[model samples]
Target: MQNQESEQVVRHPFGKFTYLLCSILTLLVGTAFMGSSRVSVMLFCLLFSTVLLTAVVSVCHRHKTLGIGLTLVVLMLILNVSSFLTRSYSLTVLHNSLVIIFLAFVFYHILSAVFHDDRVTLDTIIGTVSLYLLAGLLWSYLYSTILLVDPAAFRYDLVNAASEAVTLRNSDLQPLIYLSFVTMATLGYGDIVPVSGPAQTACYLQAVFGQFYFAILVSRLVAMYISAATHKNQQHAQGS
Candidate 1:
């Protein structure tokens, strides 16, 4: 009856948690690439592959938290493409679109879980959807950082033009990239200043976006984790 018992039981003490952690690490690494580039471009591909593999496992097990895990991987891939393409607004729009997609999938997933019989629990549904939503917003900041680096179209130029009136003279790509991260993080030390109204505006927006996204999304993620833990505990007690 060992096989029978195993087939009848499902355990998620930390399975979902581990998957979410992997996704978060992947996103952080992607963000790190914004200011630095020691990691090869191919390595990015590999990192994303790991993220996707985790997502698939989560999904296959019918984990409540798969949505967010999957969304993060997808967003990372999109951002990677945006960076390599050198196209204006490609990353920005792609980021926004991904966020919207995350929200949509979450809504549908949660609704499905609630309506379907025994396929997914309410706790799992809410936890997965919430985490995915938060990750999307956080990843958007990465997109903004990318924009700061290239300032491909009017959106980026506007930010660079207004900061401190100092025109960028550095031809070295690394310095320019570092400047973008600083602008994105709002760590303006006055070492690099925006030269025009548009540039200043871009800087202001990036700072606002970063702070706002973190304040809201991070709180949501914490709440989801707590919910997941509560659910796991309930299941454990019942099993015992």
Candidate 2:
């Protein structure tokens, strides 16, 4: 087992960080460039960068080899290329990028916890953060589908396809996105109002879950710290 583990190779933190930085820059450039005449070319580049970055992060999980990670990533890339050929690439690329972002966020927390300390305390902290991030992603996906995709069918222009408009100006939907993120972190920024039925319910539930998740993490950390302190105290008393 040890020999096999040794034989398996992985990307170091520096390499992963480099990939992430480049990928983020490419994504930003792509987004900015899309509003111009060269939108298709920019978007294609963006998708390519996203796939590359996702593969890098996924491989860092250490649960698999680089070869395995490359295989999965290449398969995803192939699908993306197919989408482009079939002319449904835009939506497919968007969906794939979202999924990759979620995966990268998760792996980042795991990497932070592992390298920072072998202690279970860090794991708890990372786990706590992951819950909120997941909630935010979920809300964003739903909002994108309901408003941006089919505003007329939904009978609301909560968030239209375009970001520049009066309906978006002073809109409550931005607050929902903020609330979704904040509530997940137990921040509970009360400024955002969820007037709609589904939005209100989702916000409330996410807030509850976020608080509960944090409470659990705090309790576990406290217990572990107290146990370690007590043990040391007893040892000192015996020595004295």
TM-score against truth, every candidate: 0.38, 0.48
What are the clash counts of all predictions, listed in order? 18, 0
Compared with the true structure, what per-residue lDDT tens digits does model 1 show for residues 1-240? Answer: 997667655443454435644564664456455422435545545654564555445443455566555656567576756655674455645644554464344445433433343333444544454444334433343344444554542222223445643333321233444455565566876665555555567567767755774576445556666787888899999999
Q: What is the lDDT of residue 175 in candidate 2?
A: 38
TM-score, candidate number 1 = 0.38
Judged by lDDT against the true structure, how good is candidate 1? 0.50
Model 2 TM-score on a 0 to 1 scale: 0.48
lDDT of 1 at 19: 66
**Candidate 1, run of 10 with poorest lDDT:** 165-174
Which tens-of-lDDT digit does each residue in 1-240 have in candidate 2? 876665663322233344444454454344433432344644654555473555356335665545555555666566555655575635554555554454554455544553454344533454434334444545644543334333332222344368643332111233334545676776754544455566556667767866775576556666667887888899999999
| Total clashing pairs in model 2 | 0
Error of 2 at 78 (Å): 7.2
